[model samples]
Target: MQVFGIAEPGAPAEEIEIATPELTGASVLVKITHSGICHSDVHCAEGYFDLGDAGQMPVTDAGAEYPFVLGHEIVGEVVAAGPEAGVEPGDTKYIVYPWIGCGECQPCRDDNENYCIGAKRNLSIALKGGFAREVWVPDSRYLIPVGDLDPAWAATLACSGVTGYAAVSKVLTEEVDRPIAVVGTGGVGLSAVALLAARGHKNIVAADVNEASLENARKAGATATVLTTGADPVTDLVTAGGGKLAGAIDFVNNGATSGLALGAMGIGGKLVSVGLFGGQLAFPTTVMALNQLKIEGNFVGSLPQLRALVDLANSTELPKLPITEAPLEAQTVNDTLQGLAERTVVGRFVMVS
Candidate 1:
C-alpha cells in the first residue's frame, strides 16, 4: 500500500510504501477512490489549534501522533471484508463515517459515537484514514452506501456536507420566519446555503471575508451576501437579513465571526457554531438571559444525519460548489495542503487515487 503522510508534526506529507492492512475481526478494507482535503487536516498537521487567550490545544491531547495519515472525507470501493463484516467485496462503493468511537460507551451505544469521550477512534486521527490507496475500517458498520452522487462530491458529505447539514438542522428545527444568516462562505457554509435552499429556505444571508467565497455562497442559493470586512459586519448581516435574522450558523467559529453572529441574532434566535477555527467566546451574560438566545456547538453529525443528508442529496439537485481534483501524489498532497493553509484554494479539493 502507498500513503502520503506526515513524518512528524509540522512536516509536509511524503509518499511512503507499507504493507497493506490485513482484514480482521469485522474489519473492512476499502480501496480508496477519492479523498477530500479538509481544513481540519491542516490544523492537525500543524499539531495544535489556536485557543485564543487560553493558549493552544495540542493534537497530542487528542491522541494524534507522527507519521499520521490525515484525510477523513473518504469515498471508496470495498475490496475485502472479514467474515464478521456485513459488507461484501465487489462493485459496491461506500463512504466511511470517520468519527468513530469506543462501541461500549453510552454515546456509541446510543448511536452518537461522534460525541464519544472514551477512546477517540476517529479515522485520520486515531486510526489511519483515506490519504492512501487503501484504508482499514474498524468495522463494517461505519460504512454508508454511496448513492448516485459524484464520488468526489459524495466524499465531502463525510465531513463538510454532513457538518453543514447538521448545523443547519439545529437552527431550522424551530419556527423561523426571518432570513437566517450563514457566517463564513467556505465549503461548509456554501453547503449550508444549498441545503437551506433545498429545504425551502428562500431567504439566506451569507457572510465571508473573501468576496469570491461570498460569490460562491450567492451561487449556492444565498439571497444576500455580506462582506465581513466592513467596520460593522454584524450590522451588515442583520441589515442584509432584513433588519432581523432568525438565527445564525457560524461556520467560521472564530472570535470575529462569533462576535458577528452573536450581534446579528434577534431575540430568541439560535446560534449554532460549527467550525473548528478555534477561539474563545466571551459575551455579556445579561444579554443572553434577557434575549433568551440559544448558542450551541455542533460537531460533525451522527450516522442518522449522514443518512438523511445522503437521501437529501439523492432527492434534489444540490447546487454545485467549486471542486479541484488532483492525483493522489506526494507533491500534489503537499501543494493542496499549502494551498488550503494559505487560503488560496477556493473550494473543496478532492484527491483521486
Candidate 2:
C-alpha cells in the first residue's frame, strides 16, 4: 500500500510504500477509493491545536522512520471483512467515524464514545491514518455503510457531514429555538447550514468574508449571509439577527468569528463550537454569566448517528452535492491539502485510488 502523510510539522505530505497493515479483531481492511481533504487535516498537520490540552494527545514527529497516514475523512469500499463483520466484499461504500472508542470503555458502552480515552490512546499517534491506498480500521463500528451514495462525497460524510448533523442534533435536543447563525462558511459550515435548514431552521445566518463561501451557504439554506469586514465585523451578524440570535454555531474558532457568534446570541442561546480553523478565542465570562448561555464543543459523531444521517441524505430529493474527485497520486495528495489551506477548494476534495 502507498500512503501520503506529513514528513514533519509544517511539511508537505510525503508518499511512501509499505506492507499492508494487519487487521486487529473485527477490523476490516478497506481499499480506500475516495477520501476527503478536511480543514482539520490542515490543523492537525500544521500544529494549531498542538498545546496538547488536558487529555489532548501530542502530535509525534512525522519525520521518524515511519510517517503515519494523516486522513480521517475516509470513504472506501469493503474489499474484505474479518472473521465476523458487517461489511462484506463488493459492498457499494461506507464512511469512517474517525474518533473511535474502545468497546470496553464506559463511554463506549454508553454509545458516547466521542470522549473515549481508550480509543484516543491507540489512534492518536502520527503512525496511522486513512490517507493511503488501503488502510485498516479497528472494527466495522467505524464504517457506516453508504450504499449507492456518491462515493466521492460519501467519504466526507464521515467527518464534516456527521459532525454537522450531530451539532445541530444537540441544538434540537436541547429544545433551543431562535434564529441561528453559523460563524464560518467552509465545507463543514455549509453542511451545517444545509442540515439545519433540512431540519426546518430557515432563520439562519452565515458569516464569511469570502463571497464564494457566502454564496455556497445561501445555496445550503442560509436565509442571510454576512461578510465579515470593517471594524466590529460582527455588526452584520447582529443586524441579521434582528435584535438577538436564538442560537449560533462557531465553525471558525478565531477571535473575530467566535466573538460575533457569541455576541449575537440572545439569552439562553446555545453556542456549539465546531472547528478550530482560526484557532483559540477567549470569551467574556461576564457576558456568559449575564446571558445565562451554554456552550459546547462538537466532534465527529458515532456510527449509528452517521447511519441515521446517511438515511436522511438519501431521502432528500435534491441533486447530489457538488462533490469533486482527484486522483490519489503524490501530487494530488499534496495539492488537496494545499488547496484547503489556501481556501481554493469550495466543496470536499475526494481522493480516488
Candidate 3:
C-alpha cells in the first residue's frame, strides 16, 4: 500500500510504502477511489489549533502522533471483508464514516459517537485514514453505501456535506420571516446554501470576504450574497438580509465570524457555529439575556444523519459546487493543504486513486 503521510508534526506529507492491512475480525478493507482534502486536515498537518487568548492546543494533546495519514472524507470500493462484516467483496462502493468511538460509551450507544469521550478512534485523527490506496475500516457499520451519486462528490458527504446539513437543519426547524445567513462561503457554507435551497428555503443570504466564494454561493442557491469586507460587515449583512437575520450558521466559527453572526441576528435568532477554525466566544451577557438568542455548537453529525444525507444525494439534484480532481501524490497532497489554508481553492478538492 502506498500512502502520503507526515513523518513528524508540522512536516510535509511524503509517500511511503507499507504492507497492505489484513482483514481480521469484523474489519473491512476498502480500495480507495476518491478522498476529499478537508480544511481540518490542514489543522492536523500543522499540529495545533489557535485558542485565541487561552493559547494553542497541540494535536499531540488530542492523541495525534507522527507518521500520520490524514484524509477522512473517503469514498471507496469494498475489496475484502471479514466474516462478521456486513459488506461483501466485488464492486460495492461506500462512503467511509470516519468518526468512530468506543462502542460501549454512552455517546456511542446513543449513536452520537462523534461526541464520544472514552476513546477517540476518529479516522484521519487517530487511525490511518484514506490518504492511501487502501484503508482498513474496523467494522462495516461505518460504511454507508453510495448509490448512483458521483464518487468524487459522494466523498465530501462524509464530512462537509453532513456537517453542513446538520448545521442548516438546526435553524430550519421553524419558519422565519427573515433570511437565514450562511457565514464563511466555504465548502460547508456552500453546502448549506444548496441544501437550504433544495429544502425549499427561498430567502438565503450568503456572507464571505472572498468574491469567488460569494459567486460560488450564488450558484449554490443563495438568494442574496453579502461581501463581508466593509467597516461594518455585520451591518452590511443585516442590511443585505433585509434588516435582520432570523438565524446565522457560522461555518467560519472564528472570532470575527462569530461576532458578525451574533451582531446580524434579530431577537430570538439562532446561531449555529460548526467550523473548527478555532477561537473564543465573547458576547455581552446582558444582550444574550435580553434578546433570548441561542448559540449552539454542532459537530459533524450522527450515523442516522449521514444516512439521510446519502438518501438525499441519491434522490435529489444537489447544488453542483466546483470540484477539482488530482492524483493522490505527496506533492499534490502538500500543495492542496497549502491552497486550502491560504483560501486559494474555491470548492472541494478530491484526490483520485
Candidate 4:
C-alpha cells in the first residue's frame, strides 16, 4: 500500500510504501476511492492541538506514531475480506466508520464506539487512515454501504457529516420553529444548516467571520446569515436569531465563537460545542444558573449516527455543500492540510484515489 503522510512530528508529509496487512477474522481491506480533508487533519499534520494556556497536546497522546496518515472521511470499495467477514468483495463501496474501539466494551457493544471506555483507536489519529491507496478495517461491521451517493460527498459523511448531525441532534430538543444558530459556517457548520433544514427546522441562522462562508451557508439552507466581523458579533447573531437563539452549534468552538454562541443563547437554550479549535470558555455561573443555559461538548459522532446520516443523505434531497476534488497525491494532501490550517478552503476538499 502507498500512502502520503507525515514522516515525523512537525515534518512535511511525503509518500511512503507499506506492505498491505493480511486480513484475518472479521477484518477487511478496502481500496480507497475518495477521502475528504477535514480541519482536524491540519492539527494532525502539525502533530499537536493547541491547548491554550495548558500548552500543546501531541497527536502521540492519541497513540499516533511516525508517518501518521491523516484522513478519516473515507469512501472506498472492499477489495478483500477475511473468511469470517460477511461482506463480499466486488464493486460495492462503503463509508468506513473510523471511530473503532475495544469490542468488549459496553459502548462498542452498543454501537457507540465514540464513547468507548477503552483507549481511543480512532482512524487518522491512532490508526492509519484513508490518505493511502487502501485502508484495513478491523471489522466488516465498520463498513456502511455508500449505495448511489456521490463518493466525493459520501467521503465526508464519515466525519464532518456525522459530526454535524450528532451536534444538531443535541439541539433538537428545542421547538422546530425556534431559531437555532450555527456558528462558523464552514463545511461542518454548513452541513448542520442543511441537516436542520432537511429536518424541517424553520429558523436556522448561520454565523461566520467570512462573508463568503455565510453566503454559502445561505445556499445550504440557512434562513439567515450573520457575518461575525462586527464590533458585537453576539448581538448580530442574536438579532439574526430573532432576539435570542433557542440553540447554537459552534463548529468553530474557539474563544470568540464560544462566547458568541453562548451569549446569543436565550433562557433554557442549549449550546453544543463541536470543534477542535482550541480555546477556554469563560461564562459566569450566575448567568448560567439564572438563564438555565446548558453547555455540552461533542466529539465526532458514533457509528450509529454515521449510519443514520448516510441514510438521510440517500433518502432526502438535502441542499448540497460545495465540494472540490483533487488527485490523491502527496503534495495535494499536504496542500489541503495547509489550506485547512490557513482557513482558506470554503467547503469540503476531497482527494480522489
RMSD of each: 1.8, 3.4, 2.0, 1.7
lDDT of 4: 0.87
| lDDT (tens digit, per residue) of candidate 2 on 1-353 | 67785666667777888776565567788788777777777766664354223333335532223364677777777777787666677856777777666668888888777766563522324236677877777787777776777777777777778888888877653333457888777667888888888887758888888888888888878888888875766677878756577788887766667777888778888888877654456789999999998888887787677888889888874223577787876677678778888988766677887
Rank candidates by lDDT, best first.
4, 3, 1, 2
Off by over 4 Å in 4: none
Clashing pairs in 3: none
Candidate 1 ranges with C-alpha deviation above 4 Å: 18-22
User: TM-scores of all models?
Assistant: 0.94, 0.87, 0.93, 0.95
Worst 10 residues of 2 by lDDT: 55-64
lDDT digits (tens) for residues 82-129 of candidate 4:
999999998888999998887778988888898888877788887799
lDDT by residue for model 3 (125-222), tens: 77788888888888899999888889999999988999988888888845644789999886788889999888878789999999998998998889
Cα error, residue 299 of model 1, in Å, equals: 1.8
Q: lDDT by residue for model 1 over 156-263, one digit each (tens)?
A: 999998898888888884444587989987778888999988887878999998898888888888999999899888788888888777788998898888878888
As a whole number from 0 to 100, the lDDT of residue 341 in candidate 3 is: 89
lDDT of 3: 0.86
lDDT of 3 at 277: 79
